[model samples]
Target: MKAMRVKNGLKISVIIMFIFMYGCKQSSYKEFVMADAVEVSESYEIVEEKEMTYKLNSNQTNVPLNLKIIKTASSRYKVKNIVTATRRIKIIAQKHGAYISDLRFQNDLYKKENRFTIKVPQKYFDTVMDSVNTVVDFVEYENITTKDVTEEYIDIETRLKTKLEVKARYETILRKNAKTVEDILLTEDKLRIIQEEIESAQGRLKYLTNKVAFSTIQIDLYEPVEYKAEPETYTKTFWDETKQGFANGWWYIKSFVVVLINLWPLLIIGLVTFFFVRKRLKK
Candidate 1:
């Protein structure tokens, strides 16, 4: 009987410990859920982007993109070198320059507090403010973006590169090669790629040469604002006023109709009851 009592006590102790442990685990889970719920507002601030495309040139346009940069005083540059070294590609970045912008690559992530510029042919407007993007490296992210601008960029560079290279080669062949048909034919195909390249390059060059040849990049490092509500839209448009008025009137009519339809049964029953009561009283 003593042995049995000891066994029962041991079992009771185990049950108590297990219940205590389970309660602790449940409390921990509730705390974790509360923490996650609190963090939701911060999660919404994650970086997001949209792609835009534009036909930036009517004339062959090429713009020379001058990139200026500022970086985290010392550490950022070293981090950028590490990123460039590891990837074997320098993701070219620029400054948001009325004065300056800062770009930092650290924690294996590219962080730009400055502006970025890419010399683009007017024909390749869709390509810029793109290409440099996050692959979601589980540890790092990359981003390159464009600034708000009243102007667009053009592509003239590719054409120039091709033309110059071709021009050099054509002169070389004309001066060096014997007049064999095969040699001439091969040279001609080369010339065709060169010609297309030249034409394309020229098209972009012309556009850049004419459009706003320079752009100012404004760097913003703060959280993006969906509304700038300080000294509001002082010159708010007539169209907006008209649209609001139209929406209010439309809503009022729809609401009135919905209430009428929903109350139809009540209205009909009341009408019947009133008529019956009136007829009986008169009789």
Candidate 2:
């Protein structure tokens, strides 16, 4: 009975230790979660908060985030005059320190359209959009979009750091123990591959940074023809209308004379029938 009591006590101690360790783990995990919940800028919000919450409760350590915000504006307008609007758009781009990246004009039976793609500094994105809106007569469609690329930027930066570290390690190995020619060549090849990977990551990071810095705007201007009613002619006097009626009667008479001249044989047959009917009536 003593042996059994000792065994039970030992089992209890094990259970208590396990509970203590689990409690400590839970505390640490909560702290980590709290630390990661940093406040974001007004222009941004946590895009993957749900995913992060799921990961924190699970065995996952890596958190997915969308942190970088890229802004784009697009506007399509149906203006009374496209030429003036196109000129105004160009001026707006220049005034807002933006550049026209693409300009296209299409003239078809349906409509005349002027398309422009402009690159503007991120700080002036709103100002440029407002300027375009002010110049347009009426807006057909307008859209502003924001995309978060924080996760991508972070991933590329992490890969770059890892590749650089790997390259340094390969360099150190080459310098320390590369005695044989084959060993040296192999180490150099590894270093080259790592260096290439580092460069690729760096280039991608730079591209994402530029995209975040600058905003793109696309404007489509169209001019639709407005319908107009035909002008009404002034009313003529009664004498003028009577003269016109006389002219019309004369025209009708000329047309009848031409028809009779062309059908002389038919006219002769009709006259003979009329005479025969009159003579039969007299008899």
List TM-score per model, in order. Answer: 0.22, 0.55
C-alpha lDDT of all candidate models, in order: 0.50, 0.86
* Model 2: per-residue Cα lDDT over 15-93, one tens digit each: 9999999999999999887766654432245557766788788856455544577898888998888998888888888
Q: Which candidate gets the maximum lDDT versus the true structure?
A: 2
- Model number with the top TM-score: 2
List of clashing residue pairs for candidate 2:
68-150
Per-candidate RMSD vs. true structure? 36.7, 27.1
Q: Compared with the true structure, what per-residue lDDT tens digits does model 1 show for residues 1-283?
A: 9999999999999999999999999999999999998788566554221111223452335653452221111111112223333232123222211212334422212332222223333333333223232311122333334442223322245447657876787868956893988888888777777777777767765644444343322222211223434574477589999998999999999999999999999999999999999999999
Residue-pair clash count for candidate 2: 1
TM-score of candidate 2 versus the correct structure, residues matched by position: 0.55
